[model samples]
Target chain A: MNFDIAIVIAIEMNIKVQNISKSYNKIKAVDAVTFEVNSGELFGLIGPDGAGKTTIFRILTTLLMPDEGNATVAEYDVVADYKAIRSSVGYMPGKFSLYQDLTVEENLEFFATIFGTTLAENYALIADIYIQLEPFKDRRAGALSGGMKQKLALCCALIHAPKVLFLDEPTTGVDPVSRKEFWQMLKRLQLKGITILVSTPYMDEASLCDRIALIQKGKILKIDAPQVITANYEKLIYDIQSKNTHGLIHDLKNYSSHYSVYAFGEFIHYIDKNVDFKPEDLQQYLEEKNHSDIIIKKAETTIEDVFMDL
Target chain B: MVFETLQVSIIIMNKEKIIQVEKLTKTFGNFTAVKGITFDVYKGEIFGFLGANGAGKTTAMKMLIGISNPTSGKAIVAGLDVATQSDLVKMNIGYMSQKFSLYDDLTVNENITFFGGIYGLSRKQIKEKSIQLVEELEMQNVANNLVGALPLGWKQKLSFSVALLHEPKIVFLDEPTGGVDPITRRQFWEMIYTQAHKGTTIFVTTHYMDEAEYCDRVSIMVDGVIEALDTPKNLKQQFKVNSMNDVFLKLARNIE
Candidate 1:
């Protein structure tokens, strides 16, 4: 059985999209977007709002028809075999679309019944996530906290054991702690041999996925492993810090050799235009501008930097 | 140089407190959302209100904005008591949230005009402000476009500009840059800095820890209590962490 599963994983490309394009009122929402997800791999569509992440998900899940191009999920054509695709794939939209007036347990049971399955039969598939929601089982869905509501939504999405899961911006406005917990849960789900495709506006979450496509304005900027994308950044970024952050940013922006400057966490990320840039010259310049306690060092490039550069 | 020095000293001498709260508490039947929280916000300060999802940030914010009544506490905003002068409190401060701010059916120009009218701006002033705002945002071509048709980043920026139409003493922003792109998010911060430079106190909340570092001071709430409040640098040092994200993780680790 293990050998048979290995063969299935090796041969199956769980999701494939070939030049899918979608438009709304003459505005291109998804422009020639194409990518694939391997079975059991966690792929991330990383982008800000209105970057066509949702449009692509809708087309893949057979909710919306693409203007052009074709896509497949779990070897089922999204257009010709939408019903088959719907039954096998789990989708959690960006918005909370669950029945708010119903109790948590009732919502789960409802979803289970619609999928022609019993909650008892598939409880083990969502045991880890459902365990957290069990405490609020009797309470109405609308009365739960933001984090609890998100947990309940995730439980309903997983009620039926799905082969592939698609999550749309699941952590957009979520707090950092809850966001971290949500990603951990996704990792566990992937371990259960489920191919997961998740979209997020948070650049930090890109690194947690096996592969990420940095998308913006309905176009794919880059696609690769997070580390590979950062490694390919062909610039020597610098972390510059001083007492007066506002003044520091202003001075750095005015610096003649500066290529790009922006606030990154506690420090300002600076990239030099000149090839042979020295820290001493910049340090001397900042000191002249009355910036005290200047600290400059070579900073590591991150997925956010790459996205901004792209 | 002399005028600049004078302006600097004048600002220092006036260290005016725009918002003050003493033992602020709010309860819903048996549960206390805000448990006697106390904090002060000075004029021109960028105060970062940080908290978990259910840590009473919204409850405290509602009380400060004068939309909800507190069960017990003393709070003053713009020299008026929130409990007794909620109407005046509502007039003295601006508010913008990511979820709801602008009308989708209204054009950009109409939205600006509507907000200006609501703030009691003269018709002439509204016209002039709308023209200037359109030019500043480089939205002249889309001035007549419906707000819903505009991009998310543009909508956020316009929402912020509308909030400042009447030039209130304080502007409360709830997750203003939640899902915007990186460059646009920084641009929004630049707008915040410009308004703050003009002595408009900014009370903002966000999930981005990096943005937390940009604030002058930040207060983290946990389990309906103010767990820590300090500048990002000082908080990092106190917690022996290198970044604000770590400080937040350390403080908010108790919640599920």
Candidate 2:
């Protein structure tokens, strides 16, 4: 098979990434990114858009090389063991890439066959997902719904029973219910002792993992359990809504108590620049400020809220 | 339960919903993408279509929009049986996808004209609505720019505004917020809110859990079935979860 030089050398990586930095000319796509996922445990790369989540995933998955760094996965150095890494870890790219003309069953079987495995051998591992696609097993993958295709791709990933699973934004375009379902499946796979590393732009999905590394601009901002990261959140949060919401956002950002005021849902998520002020005091201030139809309530910090604060 | 503070009275109960689905099923071969899912979206409501990655929300939405056929059960969208009146349903509906159903090579104005023309709007109406939509979306700066050059969020809002050019009964959005920034997500929801106020039912799918709370009702799918369908508040109360993410986890995991 004709292949690129990097592809020929991608076999020996076993989770090693050194002071790796890469830039597309002047644009720092990934800057000094370094991390490792152990042999087993679902590791999440969580962040918002343009946070270089995909770039790092691609590099570790052996699809790209950093301008300067050394990395490995599954004891196979990403470069030296390129082919070995490619065959060992099951990967589902952010975009659906299965044969669109083939039915769900055909796609699964083709993938399993490629990996020299049969559906019966890995039946238990992929049973949950395959069952969802079973009825659509005859349906063209392209015709499958977003959620259905997601499940199909997941089943394909598990068909090989890989030592690791690399899902690049698997739930990005999926529905909330499906996102929940996908995460539950990941937990099950994690229990089976498969080291899984998934990247997502959705910070909310970070909590679903056992541990996470919050990355922004190709740098590791924080690495811990979701609850711990949120616990690291120091500012008091208020979900504030008013009759004049537009005016409220403009004013709250200018308010003396503003630590960070960003629009969250139907209200502005206000963080107190002055931590000493109580909720009632702020409410009183809003009332005194002639804020009409004001509803101010103390709000718990979510993963996204923490991301915003930090 | 979720968002019960919205203050629904008996008065709220009397109004008929625009899209009423009951036991809607879409089975392919032997697998069911959407199974026995039932929900109601009232007129002028910002109904959120939510689920995990493969939770049949899109299947259900596709059936409602008449793009995909349902294997069994009944779904009445915009007072028309989707199974029998697909054409009428299509005429009364506009759909936007996560990828944003617009011609990337076309100029913004040209894309608007193309979509408006397909919806059977008069040339004059197309021109007028394009100008109006351009003003509303603040896309005057990119009126003739190639849509591919625009950001994902701008294309999303533009797709939505284009979907409503003919005043559809309900607009179905399939993961319309994907790959967009949080600020853009907020702005898109604001557009949904504004359209809802104008009596356009906004049906949207999203992965963001916090966004679920904004829905008038949310249905959770697990293993190709609508396992939980209720207002976000009701699901929260039923599952004893503080946030929609927790509620989703409880139902999706506990079921197995």
Candidate 3:
């Protein structure tokens, strides 16, 4: 490539996808999805299972060929420059894929060796995580706990010091404390000028990302800054609770003029379709139905509410 | 004879103690997986067993389900001793693991039939219950489809329903909502609420703090010992935090 062309590519987006689609048989796994990740951005692919998050990750990593459209990682075509993309990106799959029989230190060493580097060469990149796994260095990967295995996998993925990181549901099944710590680690890595594309099913984790794309059933519902997406929810929501919680849901669903109703933790989230709907009227109605000790309050919309509305 | 009859009456009056444990402990070789933890699960109550990964929650759950033998102490689940009367305890309780328990290649109806048969259900009872299960989940369209073809949320709901087919006195859910979306998770909890309303004792373990709020009472295990046990509201107040997640962080912070 000429110097001018290389400069132009450098100015363009680090990760770009145009109308990428994939399918298994007649079922569409990822539909004409288009998105871009700017350089040094922490982008999130927020969606549930079977929403085609993995398919997009696979295409971007050059592991699977897309049936339609195209993608580029680090200004290199996923197909024409598959090897280049592979060397420039790190991928931590949802399932822990490390050698279970190998000790943590051995696993890290193996990955570093496969990348044609030693831990000493890129020790700084995985220093934060390695420190946590240091005590369990001699323990086999299979014998390690979920959080430890997660750290080990992340260490292996970062051993090569790729320019971009792709993590698919990195915190699923992990405890809340560890999940918070993992995101903190990601933030630290972001400061080091590495672009990241992470996917997760947890809605609360959306706020941690710089920007998020809510995908479902192979389509992108919305993509924007977390605050912007949440602020755009145009509904009057309420958090309601009573002695008979299940009956409260059943009654609200059947009650007249109510919008979406669903259980959220211990309380029920009810949306009023009519902008002028009053909480007192609903309270009166529930009281008539023998719901005592009822508590209802206007609630703020969250990323989950936006995703559900979409 | 009168004194003995009075003792039996006292035991019968405390029927709410569906699960009673006195310092349950389990050790794997030299490593203590579950320390001397004592707690009780009342009838028709949603009891949350919470902890971080490798916090001995799984080990404690295994002992209660009569799968793993305890090194010491005692546990009586559904009025049957877990150590000596494991078979009786097993017959009166249901279990749903974190991993997908149903066979992928099998159809939904077939999987239901298999589990129902394992619980010694008759053919007629299986048929009737299978129909009701499909109707309740609105899965009639996919009843004949392979379990593998269903989405993760649907599969999880199906797995939960299958676990309840036997109508055991207590149901143990080991992180039943792991990796599931928020909407589906809420729906699954609604199902749990319905089951609890119907008089089935629910014992569940999860790392999701929001889920911890849904339980009537929760116990937080750290390392091999339970660090805290109380209602979610009390726990938040005790830790001086606004959410259960913060409470968990405050507790786990002190541990190595």
Q: State each model's CA lDDT, in order.
A: 0.93, 0.79, 0.89
Give the per-residue lDDT digits (tens) of candidate 1, residues B24-53: 999998989999999888899999999999
Better of 1 and 2 by DockQ: 1
Cα lDDT of model 1 by residue, A18-58, tens digit = 99999998999999998988888999999999999999999
Q: Residue by residue across B30-128, what tens digits does model 2's lDDT show?
A: 777777777778887777766665566667878999878779989999989999999889999989897648999999999999999999999999989
TM-score, candidate number 2: 0.76
C-alpha DockQ of every model: 0.79, 0.34, 0.66
Error of 1 at A82 (Å): 0.3
- The clash count of every prediction, one per candidate, is 0, 40, 0
Overall local distance difference test of candidate 2: 0.79
lDDT of 1 at B128: 97
RMSD of each predicted structure = 3.2, 6.5, 4.8
Interface RMSD, Å, model 3: 1.5
Best by TM-score: 1
- Per-residue CA lDDT of model 3 for B26-86, tens digit only, reads 9888998888999888888899999888999888888998989999999999999999999
- Tell me the tens digit of each residue's lDDT in model 3 across A31-56: 99999998889999999888999999
